[model samples]
Each structure stands twice: as structure tokens, then as C-alpha cells.
Target: MSSASSARSGLRGRTVVVPLIPCPRCQATVRYYVSNTEDHEGWVFYRCPNHSATGCDFWFWEMEYVAYLVDAHFLVGNQAVDAVGATEERREELIRASYERRRIATQVATSRAALARPGSLQQNMSKHQESALIGLGAEILVLLKLLLGSVMLLCALCVLLLMKK
Candidate 1:
């Protein structure tokens, strides 16, 4: 797919569940990072806290992980759908039809949600595989706090260094 078309496709928009999982190599806390510019904007990944200090190579794309998880779930759902009796060709047709139905249903659901509230940006952050809402508020809050904390920490370090001079 084209880059623009898939910009926020699938699980690309959801916040990565920040696990307090530590880096195996340095035993440092791992953290999530997102690209601010380019096609990778909003794409989240994990890396070691000691990356800057130790040049730690620890990193993972949350997008890839989420895609895998979704694929697994999709497979299971397909199996359930395929349980109904049909010839191989018919089964394939059914799968395609199911996808179309899901797309239509999602659009309908999103429109309904929009009408229910009246006025706001429509957002569907997850799942065959979309619906609607305004935004992922909790995730946004966490991100904002992290940004603010970083700025504060940077200011403190600068002040401390100037004092030592």
C-alpha cells in the first residue's frame, strides 16, 4: 500500500502498552519512542534506557508487534468463520465477503457514533478492525506528561551543569 494510505492503518495509531519490562542486555528500563517526522510519525517502538550511554542496540517496533498480534486474532476469527460448511472456492468467497461486510459495518458504526454525539473528530483506534470515537485520551495524557517531564529534566540538568562552572 502507499505510505499515505497506510499512515495510520491498523494498530499504527494506538499507544504501545508501555511494559515496565527491562532491557536484558543492560538491565536498564526500556522506553517507547516515536518518530516525529516522516512516514514513521506516531509509530512507537521500545528501546533501552542505557541506549545513549552504552550505545545499546535494544529496540522494537510496536507496529510490527501489534500487527502480529492482530494477525493471530484474525486467523482465529477466520477459523471460526470457516467452520461453516462450504466448498474450498465457496469458503474463499465467503472470507472475502466477510471482509467487505466488516468494512461496511465499521463505516456504519462510525457514522452512528458521530451522530450520537454530534461534532468532534471521528477516531477508531483499534480492531476487523475499525469503529469510532473522538480520541485515545488516556494515551494522549501519558504522552503529554512524558514530554513535559523531559523538558523539566533537561532544564534541571542544564542548571546543575552551570552551577558546577
Candidate 2:
């Protein structure tokens, strides 16, 4: 088939129209999300909606299909596949390779920039701060009680002196 069609081959209807390419299997919407790859690239997929009574089993990565189309001389851009000249396998191969190279470069940069693994650091810090605050609060309460006691003692001594006078 044409190069672009070959690239987008496996993608069939999606739950959402993400790649703009209809799923070849069910002619449904295709959904896309951030890829786990270093750069969090966009990845697309297709699945029949539960709304469908039969709920035909259809799912595939829009990623692979796009790669294939690029390999086959089809350019998917601006929500349209240039399916005109994907017949030349060699040219398609070159295009796909070029795209792959760029993808790898982006992944490398993303990996490098992501220095820290996300988790407990913030939570731990919050816990420590909270503990410190609780301790400070308790100290304030203790100081208040001590001050009140001293004031009462001073008042009692003053009354005794006045009685002696």
C-alpha cells in the first residue's frame, strides 16, 4: 500500500481523535498521550468505545503506524497524511530513519535534564517542618503557663505585705 497508509496501518479507531488518523480497524477516533520516553513524546492509540454494544476489540500504537508511514514515504503532518508518494520503499526508509534519529536526540536531552526521580523528598521536608511547628507551639503554651503562675505568686505576696502593713 502507500507509504503513509503503511505507516498508519495498525492504528484503528481511537477513543479520541488525537493523531487525526482514523483507526484503520474500526474507523474510530484515536487518542494520544505523553510517551514515557525521556522527552515525554506524544504517543497515540486507538480503542473501540464502550458505547459500542459489541465493543469490538481494537487497539494499536499510533506510534508504530506513523513510523511505518515515514518508512514508506508518507508524511503525516498537520492532521493529514501525505499518502501520495509512499510507494518508494527506499525513500520511506530514509525519512523514517531521519525521524528516528531526531527522536533519539530529543530523548537524550530529556533524560539528561531530568536530574531527580520524583518522590518523598517534599513529603519528608513537610513532615520535618510540621514537627518543628508543633514543638514551637508546645513551647509557647508552656511559657504562657509559667508567666501566669509567676503573676499569681506576685499578687499573693503583694496581698500579704498589705495585710502586714
Candidate number of the best TM-score: 2
Every model's TM-score: 0.30, 0.32
Model 1 / residue 149 / CA error / Å: 86
Which residue pairs in candidate 1 have backbone atoms (N, alpha carbon, C) closer than 3 angstroms, thus clashing?
Answer: none
Per-residue lDDT over 14-37 for candidate 1, one digit per residue giving the tens place of the 0 to 100 score: 322223354667877666566554
Write down the lDDT that model 2 would get: 0.51
The TM-score between candidate 2 and the true structure equals 0.32
In terms of lDDT, the best-performing candidate is 1
- Residue 46 lDDT (model 2): 37
Which stretches of candidate 1 lie above 4 Å from their native place? Answer: 1-18, 65-165
Clashing pairs in 2: 7-65, 7-68, 7-69, 12-23, 12-24, 13-23, 13-28, 14-29, 71-92, 73-92
- For model 1, what is the error of residue 56's alpha carbon versus the real structure, in angstroms, after optimal superposition? 0.5
The lDDT values for all models are: 0.52, 0.51
